[model samples]
Target: MAKQWLNKVLELGEVKGGLAWGRFLFDGNRWVTLMEQAPKGKLVGTDYHGNRYFENEGDIYTRKRFVIYAEKRTNAYNPTSVPPEWHAWLNYINDYEPTTFDYKPPVYALKAEVTATGTPKGAWADPDKRNWLKYSAWAPPSSGARGGKA
Candidate 1:
């Protein structure tokens, strides 16, 4: 949180990948956590985007599955970074692992907000709303509100 505030004030922009996370070039804490969890879990598979999935059946009641995102922490926090097939398995929608070869989202699935934003597909998002430092009168359009219809 402090880093985000500092970035905005200094116009330094967002943190550069994971290097800024710890004293080392890599995320030390994550590495440490993984080292500890290594024995309790086994890697499932890596998705097309390089996100690694793991399943821990060490205990039947506490069995769990999770993904270690390949994207930087900042990018990973964005929900859109996780694709649908992976999400399905993570959420128990499907017990089987998805084949990661050339994984393309289904036509019905929405595109990532980062890709959709500032594009026709995500016109609903208002950049002004994200600009907390600036005052904006922008209001999201209601159903049939912006157009002449209603």
Candidate 2:
């Protein structure tokens, strides 16, 4: 079991660099948890986005379910990134596996997913309420250029 899990980890951490892919990407706690908790869980299924779901029968309480998101390589996942069906299973909302069921999202839901992913939340869209500096090239003026002492 340990060897199989190690092989999976090696496969997961392998990248085009020919070295461990996620070593530099994930933080310390995340890396450790991935190495430890993973050994106890059985791979339940994988979602369309590549998120891997695991179930640990040994863990009767707390979270028996967990997910290794598709974006683990870049460590860029968030709760918002998971699809609704997968989210439901992860949170124990349902015991059913996501892809096994016949399900289709509403048209509006799909649109929202596409729009939200490439941009910020609509509530934070107003420029006056927040700065877009992080997502934009708009830099503040130099002190001298802005009429401050050089």
Candidate 3:
């Protein structure tokens, strides 16, 4: 029993060491995001996407920049969520925030695949697959107008 306890204690110490050195991005799956505790940097500004940008000029050798997402669940956060301007700052592309730069988001053409029954369609369906005559919008010629013709 003593040996087992000692092993567990040693494992815990290793985990602590890894966290202190920033080896892992997560911190016990808490509500806080990883970037919130990223390098101790100054809060520069927030981007349009609500991502907070930070920069630390503490020392020439250790200067760093990071971002903490505003998403409630940070674990599912993706780096792509950061806009181009903030992305530039995070990557040190420019010394200043890309305020005046014009950024056009890429447009994507998306189409729905699921059928009315909620089952995913394995193959694409033809738009004109159904017969339209049965559901035609124009009403049949009036019998009186045609002198009671069929």
Candidate with the greatest TM-score versus the true structure: 2
Better of 1 and 2 by TM-score: 2
Off by over 4 Å in 3: 1-39, 59-63, 99-150
* Residue pairs with clashing backbones, model 3: none
Candidates ranked, most accurate by lDDT first:
2, 1, 3
How do the predictions measure up, each by TM-score? 0.45, 0.58, 0.40
Clash pairs, model 2 backbone: none
Error of 1 at 42 (Å): 1.5
lDDT for predicted candidate 1 compared with the true structure: 0.55
lDDT of 2 by residue, 30-67 (tens): 46546766677788888666678888888765568887
| After superposition, candidate 2 runs with Cα above 4 Å error | 1-5, 13-26, 72-74, 106-108, 111-150
CA shift at 28, candidate 1, in angstroms? 9.4
Better of 1 and 2 by lDDT: 2
| Residue-by-residue lDDT tens digits, candidate 3, 9-32 | 333223345454353334344212
Each prediction's RMSD over C-alphas, in Å, is: 13.9, 9.0, 14.9
